[model samples]
Target: METTFDAADFHQTKLQNQLIQQLAAVEAQSNSTWATQQGQNSTRLAIALNLI
Candidate 1:
């Protein structure tokens, strides 16, 4: 019985860690995508101003 409880706790901890890692990865990806978009917009604005 003790072994079973220990195994369950270990599994829960592992799952929690996995979820946290996944969330961090997703947040990083979103931040990167947002930065890229901002860079592109800045470039376009610069180009438009130069054209005028």
Candidate 2:
């Protein structure tokens, strides 16, 4: 009985850790995408200004 409970707890902890890692990865990817978009917009604006 004790062993079973321990195993369940370990499994739960492992799943939680995996979930946190996945969320962090997603957040990082989102930030990277946003940064890339911002950089592109800035470049376009600079080009437009130069055209004027």
Best by TM-score: 2
Off-target runs (Cα >4 Å) in candidate 1 are 1-5
Model 2 lDDT tens row, 9-52? 98999999999999999999999999999999999999999999
Error of 1 at 4 (Å): 11
TM-score of each: 0.88, 0.89
Model 2 ranges off by over 4 Å: 1-5
Give the C-alpha miss distance for residue 46 in model 1, angstroms: 0.5
Considering summed lDDT, which 10 consecutive residues are worst modelled in model 2? 1-10
Which lDDT value does model 1 have at 31?
Answer: 100
What's the CA error at residue 7 for candidate 2, in Å? 0.5
lDDT of 1 at 51: 100
Measured on C-alpha atoms, candidate 1 has an lDDT of: 0.95
